[model samples]
Target: MERERVNRKIAAIFAADVAGYSRLMGMDEEGTLARLKAHRRELVDPKIVEYYGRIVKTTGDGMLVEFPSVVDAVRCAVEVQRGMVERNAEVPQGTRIEFRVGITVGDIIIEGGDIFGDRVNVAARLEQLAEPGGICVSGRVQEDTQGRLEIAFEDAGERQLKNIARPVRVYRVRPSAAAATARPALTLPEKPSAAVLPFQNMSGDPEQEYFADGMVEEIITALSRFKSLFVIARNSSFTYKGKAVDIKQVGRELGVRYVLEGSVRKAANRVRITGQLIDATTGAHLWADRFDGALEDIFDLQDRVATSVVGAIAPKLEQAEIERSERKPIGNLDAYDCYLRGMASLYQWSKESNDEALRLLYRSIELDPAFVSAYGAAAWCYVWRKTQGWVANSAQDKIEAIRLARRAVELGKDDAAALSAGGITFAHIAGDLDGGAAFIERALVLNPNLAGAWLNSGWVRVWLGEPEVAIEHLARAMRLSPLDPILFRMQGAMASAHLFAGHYDEASAWAEKALRENPNLQQGLRVAAASHALAGRLEEAQKAVARIRQLDPDFRISNMQDRLPAVLRPQDFARYAEGLRKAGLPG
Candidate 1:
């Protein structure tokens, strides 16, 4: 007898088992084993090695492997599936071998050259959950595998497993084409809906990819404010990043009826952004434009791109709105360059990013004090500090935020960003909800492409107890800024509005969808909890409450007034409060 001791480490475990293996073996035992051996030797093993994965054990019909990295595990899984696909092409569909693979990353006990732990068990269970010729992965694997692989994952939610101590979050992974084809085509809701696809970096310079992506994001942010758009989050849209995709396929995968696609090319001293809008169902080009400008005038270029995109989708969008979308700094374009850098920093949403963004934004305003957008960006830094609890004096930050926001509006009343920021600051910090809503609405009318304006307007309406109207505006915002990072805020607003209207099911569904994009979205958790409670789902409501506390331990309705827009109508306030209470929110 020999004894061995080794420390346990967290690793991605990949478990796979052949589907219908018993039937195949029963049909021809020797042939089945021989074919399986040959496949492993010739195709599967090499790909696994190529992806830097190690095989731990092999059952006659299944294999268990350990990957040093999650990226490798995912890549190996995708390649194995792809290779299997090619190998199966020659055989009759019914006679071809298929595999169901499951991946999980967690701590596992290693003993006697065999792996053992709950993690292993979870992977095995997930493998069982996978469809034939498909891959299933634990939530841990999903989080770790993003940005490192070219795979698409559909949420399977929590699943109950036999003998498993707890339910597991699972994601189903399949070939992108197969997944798109598998989705049932559904009619668009009467509501406004849209999808944002990754903008192609036609600049030829790889460094400019981030710039092009950032511009798309800004456009999405502007549209998200409209409150009438069903904007897909950036993460969802960016999944198609660097992939050749069809507009119809994008719509089907994202469940949006309209699609926005474009390319960005930047030369030494000139830049051009070309965009097109298409009806996803018909694949008909609804609108197209090419924006060319000096590199120094990048801000103006972005504004033009946004205006053209908005004008194409909603012909009724007024010229005033287009002008608002085109608003930029009145002084040096250098300041605008700094502003873009500031925006890039802000997108990171970290302490370091915040500091860098604040510094750059201040520099932009210093160079061009008349720059209303810079003021708005500065106000946002205060908002971020306050929200993140990084402010030394919350009251002071609120006052400064309100002042800067108001200044932005005064300086650029025609600018959508200025109006949007001013309205949000007034509603959330100044406690002047009606005034804020009015400003946001004015901004929206001036630029239907202003997603932020629509989103803010929708928030105001929801606070005023007009949920149906809010939903429309939010949907429009979504359409304009389908790839915005903060678009989840609009989704949460929609859910909140639905909850207040006593549309519990719709509220829950939207909230779930929002959380799907951002699991830690506080507003989504609140709305989801309230919706579940209103629908008599006490367990679910409690679970949502638990999640809320996990994210914001000190959260309560009493403090919500300071945190939320104050423009809500009495009825709306009461309804929202009631839902929160029912959802187990503390008074």
Candidate 2:
């Protein structure tokens, strides 16, 4: 006869242990055990029962508890810590006892009165990872307990626990001291800075990797609405592909302070997403969460994930306010899917990719005309064509770009992409410098988190002969899109702005920085040549100009209007032209 196995519906399993338990026991085994018993009897047991938690068992130094709700587990954990803190305050420093606790919500098996499963194993591991006297919970528990407690939680990111089959997302409830420390550090930046990394694909389908990648790009686009955040561009972050990296390293490499990483998994009709934020300097987990829903409800999932992420970083983020900002087109999930596909193509940055991107963007818009991002992207394609001189019909291309950009603005007046692309088109092709600058400014004011708006607006300011202002905006753009492939553009814009403002030394320095990243950056070359000339370094100016001519044989200052955007004020144009002439560009 086979032995009978008991099954029970397990909601959450909590495991806790004292840090340095062995050391304490070794020093005074009987005394330690006696104190542990006293503490359990006087504080821990009562609090667990108060929270409606069941104490499954207790070792000499640890305890295992089960709860029907994750909230109960966390509340009990907080109470345990608060009680311990007060108790320790009265004891000597050397004799003070501290406990590390971990909680997870998962299915488990019950044998007799003891619970056993991977869930229990995971909680044990998390407890070990927790700092002494701190509480760490899995992503599931964090979501389950959110808004049900008064304490704030910080994301610890995903950790590959010992013997675990997969990485676990973890969160640490901000300890009282940590929370107090954070309050005084809440000095807002003149411009906010952010980073978006590739979202993980949990679906176990290798082919769906592109879909996950597309989702991240879409998020970058969406968040690029706020002009205040210095958004790290996608290319910069994607460079770390396929590598197991620390978020702190990412922050350092990208030169941003905050890092966002997440994973996406989809199966049939269900989808699951996990995300976390980390402070780069301290390697501290700032926030972590998991969102699971039906595949048909992906839009809601994305919005919720974005909202949660923003709220984690900026506690003041209000759901009601974000919901009222704008809404995407409804009834066309396929179109939205296609738009994501198009974004993947656009990120490739080659002519072949651009062509494919155009096709997909147009197809998406055809499916849903109100998909404003698609229209904005289509307009960008034309801008790319004009910049690369790849257009077979410049007149027709500009006309189409202008039309698409205008339509994007009309449909997405509140969207960052629409305002950004429209402003770029108007400034570059339509020669509406002031109007374009104002539009970009409006986009930034409307969405302080939008990186693109700041970047484009910085360029607009440069064109308007306000290099000082341009540099300020461009620096903020760099902060927002630290990983952006087009970061060279921002650097080049800064150099050009400095050059136009007659800050030759600063221009040379910034141009060199840009050149270090991309040796063949045309704008950097132009600015470097001008800076060298203005600073009376004729030899370096000639060398830079030579490189420019080699790269573009027909390069000339006067004809630059045809090759570049026409958003420049007269003063700005003259300043650049004089620099080029001084740098020995042929008339």
Task: Name the candidate that leads on lDDT.
Answer: 2
Query: Which portions of model 1 miss their true places by more than 4 Å?
Result: 1-207, 214-240, 247-294, 297-331, 348-356, 380-392, 479-485, 568-587
1-587, model 2: which lDDT tens digit per residue?
99876696776888998888888888888898889888888888988987789889988688999999888889889868876876677587766679999999899998888898899999999999888889999998888877767678899999999999999999998744433442121112334456778887888888788778766765665555443445566666777667787776566466567888888888888888888888874588889998899877776777777666666666665666555423444457788878878877876666788889999999999999888888988888887766654566778888888888889889877776688888888887777888888778778777665667887888888887788999899877876555567777788888988887889999988898888877767778888988888799989888998998987787787677766676767776676777789989998
Best by TM-score: 2
Candidate 1 contains a number of clashing pairs equal to: 34
Residue-level error in angstroms, candidate 1, position 6: 88
Give the Cα RMSD of candidate 1.
Answer: 17.9
Candidate 2 residue 526 C-alpha distance from true site, Å: 2.4
For model 2, the run of ten residues with the poorest summed lDDT: 181-190
Q: Would you estimate the TM-scores of all the predictions?
A: 0.55, 0.62
Q: What is the C-alpha lDDT of each candidate?
A: 0.77, 0.78
Q: How much is 15 displaced in model 1, in angstroms?
A: 48
Off by over 4 Å in 2: 1-196, 204-206, 218-239, 251-259, 277-289, 310-319, 322-326, 329-331
